[model samples]
Target: MRLAEIPLCVWRTRGQTFLFRGQNIRYWTAGQGEPLLLIHGFPTASWDWHYLWQPLAQRYCLIACDMLGFGDSAKPVKHHYSIVEQADLQQALLAHLQVRQPVHVLAHDYGDSVAQELLARHHEARAAIASCVFLNGGLFPERHRPVLIQKLLLSPLGWLVGRSFTRDDLVKHITQIYGPQTRPSESVLDDCWSLIDANHGTRIIHKLVGYLPERIAQRGRWVGAMQHGDVSLRFINGAFDPVSGHHMLERYLELIPNPDTVSLHGIGHYPHTEAPGQVLRHYLAFRQQLQPFKKIACS
Candidate 1:
């Protein structure tokens, strides 16, 4: 979709706002079936799911939201953004929607960490995440290769980097993460920049980037969830993603037993955006295989 049409798409979704911890969070819901929660990556919003929204909604009740400091959500300047807090917001959204059914999670980048935390809660009989499908992300902090800009954003000079980073820089850095063959168009890149720049989001980016260190510190708890959690898990990776592509997949295979994975050759960090058809296909296939097990669990 072109940048010109992004607003139309957002309008069609008819996103609404919910009060979360005294902040208004932007969210969208559609269709009516088993609940499917979508968590987007860093520096982006729920709109990241725009590519697969309708298709996925056709099969499941879709729930997506912009966490604090992202997308159309409240961006409190001093609020500390952490994966655990984001997990709390996800749970709050489910409860607000009165979603009693076990939910399937589709997450990417920063969202992956939030999903991991949710999975950990599920292990503790706290959340009802039935399954999870991870896109490219720093699942293992050790294997995560942050780009130069990310490193800068996480450094002591991060505040300066956030203030000085421009749209061109965003396009440049984002382009580097995409596969060589499947780079995003200027319009898409523009939309990304606009989303990031909206409501002074760039200002709090340094604070949000805190997730990197938090990921490392809490790696044991989150990875333990994936390693031992009862919920079904799948990793659908874009093989060409520089940040967490093939190498990340290798780590997943090494650590996760009986792993279910799909590697899209030449695809990049944003698989759903870069190749929505392939992502939808694999995701649906994974869900289809879970039907029998889902029924048993629900019973």
Candidate 2:
């Protein structure tokens, strides 16, 4: 069934904020069951989950936040942004909420990297993540194919590029990542640009793009966590995504033992947005196969 869409304004209204390390982080939560955490990709926020929010919330308590520099959250121009810090933010949020049960993580793009770090913690018995499902992302640095804009953002001229970047430029770059047949609507693109433009977020694009290099430098830790972690794992990919599509899936199957995967033939980077129904169906099927967790006790 096609899920009803959650409008951006309503999404904003439903959200609440809490301070994290002197920055305001916006978050949204609903439903009640096993805890499920949703982490979005770079340049986007928790609103990325709006399409699947209600449908997934039907079966799991949902938690999603605009990480320190993205969405409606604070964007500190001088602060350093790293996947490790983002993972810590997620842990802090879970702790702040007093979530005692192991969480089921659904992460996309940049979020996939953050999930990898969290999974690394789980592998070391430092965190309680029950499972992780990755959408399109740079899971393996070698397999990731960043677009031209991303390359530019990483160059020495990156700060200047971020300063001069325009909404049209963002829309153009985002369009390149989706399947031709499933490209986002103008309105959808507008909402995405709105979130990025919030709190002068565009000014910090260069810093946030650091996750690309960070992924490469810490490849062993993150990738090893995926290969060795005992938690349930699944990869749901959109085949046409230029950045991390079929090729990345090939690498995943090569490295991850007993891999569980689902490939959306004509979809692209934003599977949850481009084809929410299929994503929902596949994700639900995967969750159904997992053993049930004990009810989470309230604080």
In model 1, the Cα lDDT at residue 245 comes to 90
Q: Give the least accurate 10-residue stretch of model 2, judged by summed lDDT.
A: 290-299
Runs with alpha carbons beyond 4 Å of true place in candidate 1: 1-13, 291-299
lDDT string, candidate 1, 1-299, tens digits = 32112352554359888899999988999998999999999988888888788877788999999888887788888888888999999999999999998999999999999999999899888988889999999999999999988899989999999999899888878899998888988887777787788789889888898999999999999999998936788888898998999999889888886778888888889998888878888788889885212110100
Model 1: lDDT of residue 96 = 95
lDDT of each: 0.86, 0.90
Please provide, for model 2 over 1-299, each residue's C-alpha lDDT reduced to its tens digit, 9 standing for 90 to 100.
57789999899999988889989999999999999999999888999899899988889999999998999999999999999999999999999899999999999999999999999999888889989999999999999999888999999999999888888998889999998898888898889889999999878988999999999999999999988848888888898898999899889888887788888888899999888998898888779886322221111
Task: List TM-scores for all candidates, in order.
Answer: 0.93, 0.96
Candidate with maximal lDDT:
2
